[model samples]
Every structure is written in structure tokens, then in C-alpha cells.
Target: MAEEQLVTFGLGTEEFGVDIMLVQEIIRIPPITRVPKAPDYVEGVINLRGNVIPVVSLRTRFGMERVEESDLSRIIVLQVQNKVFGIRVDAVTEVLRLDTESIEPPPPVALGMDSHFIRGVGKIGERLLILLNLDNIMGGEINHESA
Candidate 1:
């Protein structure tokens, strides 16, 4: 059976994962420079090895309550459609490979989150992983025009 690798992370009490291939790197939360007119979810930009990469708060983007940064907080650098950006997440859990057949379509009720953002639900033993569609999550919001 075919298997796919995933980079899993936590947001509040929930766990989320994205395609490992799209992840550029993972770093500890870094200092951010706020952009005057950026959207609420946009936490501004950070200089990564001289490149100004925009950063977004996943909590705010998902309409969740913002919490103070903790030791576990991390910034997941991702490349979507050739655009590089970082997303602040509570904590990165682990990298795991799941069988493709174990993934099912998103359920009919997605707890009010836009179903389009969810790529699939992966079953790993007794654990259920919410696989996010990175394209849909960052594509519409992080295009150059919006930056």
C-alpha cells in the first residue's frame, strides 16, 4: 500500500498535519515585525537568512483565541505554490507515515471549519489525524497581492 509522510502539529487540544514535502523547515518562534496594514491573521514578517518571509498566526486564522507563546511554540516554514511563508503553531508533534488507504474524506460536519481546508482524515491505529490542505489554507490568503 502507498504511504504518505506528514508533519504533525498541535493547535490547542487538536492535532493537524500537512504534507511533509511542502514543509521547508521548522523553527522556534522568532521575533516578528508587524506590517501596518496586514490582515489580523497576518502576524507580519520575519527575516530568515536575509529573506523577508511573512508569518501568519494559525490560531487567529482559524478564529481561535490567541494565547501567549510558550516553550513549545514553533513556526512551520512552508512553501505553497512557490511562495514561502511561516505559520505559528502551538507545537510540532511528530513526523509519521500513514497509509493512503487509511485516509478518508472529510466528514459531513467539520465543526464549522471550512471543509475545503481539510484534505482528509487519516486513521493511524486509534488516533485520527486531521490532514490540512496547505494549498487551500495559504493559497488564497498569502498570495503576493495580499502581502
Candidate 2:
């Protein structure tokens, strides 16, 4: 029975997970410099120890209502395809391991989020975690809505 370690975080009322290996570090929200002409989901860039990493708002990416950042807010730094970026999340819940058998393909609707962003659904007891598909997150063929 192979198990996958995941880092779970909160967005709105739902929970999401990403492979722990992809996570570089988690930090509290830092002062972000807004970038003009960036995508709506792209909140801005942050200076992390001299590294200018772009930050994405998970709420905006999921088309959810934006809320004020609280003490629980965190920025999860992830490395995908040799690129490093940060995702601003409401709160980080916990890290856990789940058996691969517990994961299922994304449903048709995928809880209202674009199915493109979901890799699969993992079930743990009564909790359902939406595993993120990092491949489609950045530098992929993206469709921007007309404002």
C-alpha cells in the first residue's frame, strides 16, 4: 500500500491538498508588490530573501470571493517544473499521508472549480481533499475571461 504525503490547506469552506514533496516552505503573508498587467489570479510578486517570486491568490484562481488576510493566512512556496512560486492560502490545516487507493479521478464538476486545476479527489475518513494539478497552474495554455 503506497501512501502519498500531502500538505492540506483551506480555501473558503473547502480543503485542498498538494504533494508534500512539491512544497518548499510555508511562510506568513509578506508585503507583496503589485505587478501591473499581471493576470487577475496573480496577486503580485514577493521578495523572499532576495528572490522575487510571483504569488498567486488561490481564492482568485478558484473564482471565489476575496477576503482580508488574517493571522491564519499563509503563503505556500512550491516548486513545479523547476519553477518556484507561492500560493496564498487562507490557512494551512495539516500534513497527512493517504493511500493512493483512496484517490479518485476528478468528478465532472469538481466542486465548482475548473476541473483543469484538480488532479484528483482524495478521501480520508469524512474529509475530501481536492488534490491540485500543478502542471496546469502556470505557464500553461490559460484562458482569461473578458473583464
- Candidate with top TM-score is 2
Error of 2 at 142 (Å): 9.9
Residue by residue across 28-108, what tens digits does model 1's lDDT show? 988899999888888999999999999989888778999999999999999987889999999999999999999999998
Tell how far residue 139 is off in model 2, in angstroms.
Answer: 4.9
Model 2 Cα shift for residue 105 (angstroms): 0.6
Q: Where is the poorest 10-residue window by lDDT in model 2?
A: 138-147
Clashing pairs in 2: none
Q: Ten-residue segment with the worst summed lDDT in candidate 1?
A: 138-147
Q: What is the alpha-carbon lDDT for the whole of candidate 2? A: 0.91
Q: Per-residue alpha-carbon lDDT of model 2 for 23-114, expressed as tens digits?
A: 99999999999999998989999999999999999899888999999999999999876789999999999999999999999999888888
Give every collision pair in model 1.
none
For model 1, what is the error of residue 82's alpha carbon versus the real structure, in angstroms, after optimal superposition?
Answer: 0.3
